[model samples]
Target: MFGDMMGMMGKIKETQQKIEETKKRLDTVLVDEQSNDGLLKVTLTANRQVKTIAIDDSLLEDKEQLEDYLVIVMNKAIEKATAVNEAELSAVTKESMPNIPGMDMFS
Candidate 1:
């Protein structure tokens, strides 16, 4: 029983290491998205931090429409960034988890 416990502890350490590496990988990921008409573009990191925003000069003539376009484009960027983060986390989870019976990976 004690030997099993030691092995489980080793697996836990390995998972922790993998998760840290995954976080670093996620930091390097950038997701970019644009509005349907391509008048606006938004870029964000996989960690969901806004990186850059671009707007076409034509849209500057209409305040309301420009605001709507910005909102739409920002939402798209956020959604894409979220997907990137989730995919990274899922990869780490799958890589870390062992097929050990009666084991709760997170517990």
Candidate 2:
């Protein structure tokens, strides 16, 4: 029983290390999305934090139109970031537990 407990603790420590490493790697991942005409752009980190945005000069004339386009591009960038975050997390989890059955349920 004591050996089993020690083994479990070791596994837990290893998993935590893997999670921390994943977080560090994910922090540097940036997801960017642009509008169809390349007039609007948005960027986000894998953790869903907004990093940057750019708009074309042509849209400066209309605040409402620019705001609308900003909303669309922001949402797209966030969605892309979320997808990337999930994929990164899933890969990390898989690496930690390579042979666990039904692990996809958690990811």
Candidate 3:
């Protein structure tokens, strides 16, 4: 029993390291989103950090419209980034987890 416990502990530590590495890699994974008419564009990392935003010159003339476009585009980009981040982390965690009875939470 002690040997099994020790192995499990080691596996958990390894999984933690993998998770951290996956997070760092996610920082380089980019997600892009744009307004329906392409008036606004946004690029962000899978870690949800904004990288760039581009807006049409016409949008600058209408403050409200520009704000609306920004909100929509940014939200969409964030949603995509969140999905990518979650999927990558989940895959790393599930793959590294030790197979123990009643510990199938990742399933």
Q: Write the per-residue lDDT of candidate 3 for residues 11-105, one digit (tens) a residue.
A: 99999999999999999999999999999999999999999999899999999999999999999999999999999998998899998899888
For lDDT, the strongest prediction is: 3
Task: Please give the lDDT score at residue 3 for candidate 2.
Answer: 85
lDDT of 2 by residue, 27-104 (tens): 799999999899998888888888888889999999999998998898888888889888877777666653435545
Ranking by lDDT: 3, 1, 2
Give the CA lDDT, 0 to 100, for residue 21 in model 2: 85
Candidate 1 stretches with Cα past 4 Å from truth are 100-107
Between which residue pairs do clashes occur in model 2?
none
Provide the RMSD of all predictions against the true structure, rounded to 1 decimal. Answer: 2.5, 2.4, 1.1
User: Model 1, 31-99: lDDT tens per residue?
Assistant: 999888888988888989888888999999999999999888888788888988888887777777665
What are the lDDT figures for the candidates, one per model? 0.84, 0.82, 0.94
Residue 73 lDDT in candidate 2: 90
Please provide TM-scores, in order, for all candidate models, with all chains considered together: 0.82, 0.82, 0.94
The predicted structure with the larger lDDT, 1 or 3, is 3
Name the lDDT value of residue 89 in candidate 2.
79
